[model samples]
Target: MNRNLAYALVVFAATAAAAGQAFAETPTLETTPFVSVKTRADVQAELAQHKANGVNTYSIQYNPLKSFKSTAQREQVVAEYIASRDVVAATTGEDSGSAYFAQARTPHSVSRTLAGTPVNTAR
Candidate 1:
């Protein structure tokens, strides 16, 4: 009985340690950016460029989740939050995906989808 209890505790302790590490490694408020910019572009441009380069696809990725405070300065915080995401997408060339965010002091959360297209200038 003592050995069994000890083994169980060891397993639990290991799991707890792992979970704590993950949380600690997660991005902090200061590390995460608060401004972003993106371009509405020709998606096919990537496809064509990749093909010409003998590749099947070109892709970019960014963290889709963002956090903000909904305190008295909700609008300011939210604006910065959204801008930060735009910058990520533009910098990485990530063109698709949505945002899932939560306020710092409330249960309020939001999800928003972004779409874009490049204007044809050759005409």
Candidate 2:
């Protein structure tokens, strides 16, 4: 009985050591460089093509009241925005246009509870 107990303990310790060594060997990852890289001329040609695709106008909008601390700060923000827009328009052969606003729907079009009655929520 003593010899069998000793044999069992040795087997268990050897199995545990083998498992630890097996887990210690980690596999390494290999990577390759990109097959094709774009050059400066390639990027320029792409931009020219984009310009020819009728994407010639852009618009910028900002809420100055929420973004700025005071009127002077708001004016400075607007000036900077206009300057940046002018720069992009000149460089890309595009024009800066007026700000766009989505049209709001009438109250009757929107769902509302009328006179303590349940409204139909399904479309």
Candidate 3:
């Protein structure tokens, strides 16, 4: 009978400890109601402005560039593309232009005054 009582006491203490830990880990939430910062009229005015600017929020065929007009001629655009072709290729190649940039870099020339050594007095 004493052994059974001690076992029951230990089981009860373990269950109470586990329940207390579970309760401690849970946080009580404070509810705060939302306050509107804009009036209905202001929201309607903004929606009207967006519609006037050709912004269709609910359209399935929305095109942002529908009203775009090109200022450059086709020949000028082609020439610009051709001029930058080599650079674009080098940068986008498998090596990612590291070799091309390394080759293009020029070594810095140090002047006598900045070389931290005395210049020739004979000169």
Best by lDDT: 3
User: Residue 6 of model 3: what lDDT?
Assistant: 100
Per-residue lDDT over 1-123 for candidate 2, one digit per residue giving the tens place of the 0 to 100 score: 999999999999999988874346677866875666888899999999988865544624433344455547778998999988855655455322322111234666777657967577677
lDDT of 3 by residue, 2-112 (tens): 999999999999988888643456677769978899999999999899889886867988887878999999999999999999999998999999999977777674323
Better of 1 and 3 by lDDT: 3
Report the C-alpha lDDT of model 1 over 42-76, residue by residue, as the tens digit.
56676677678653323443323334544568789
lDDT of candidate 1?
0.59
Number of the top-ranking candidate, with TM-score as the measure: 3
Residue 11, candidate 2: alpha-carbon lDDT:
100
lDDT computed for candidate 2: 0.67
Error in Å for residue 70 of model 3: 0.8
lDDT of all predictions: 0.59, 0.67, 0.86
Candidate 1, 72: how far from true, in Å? 61
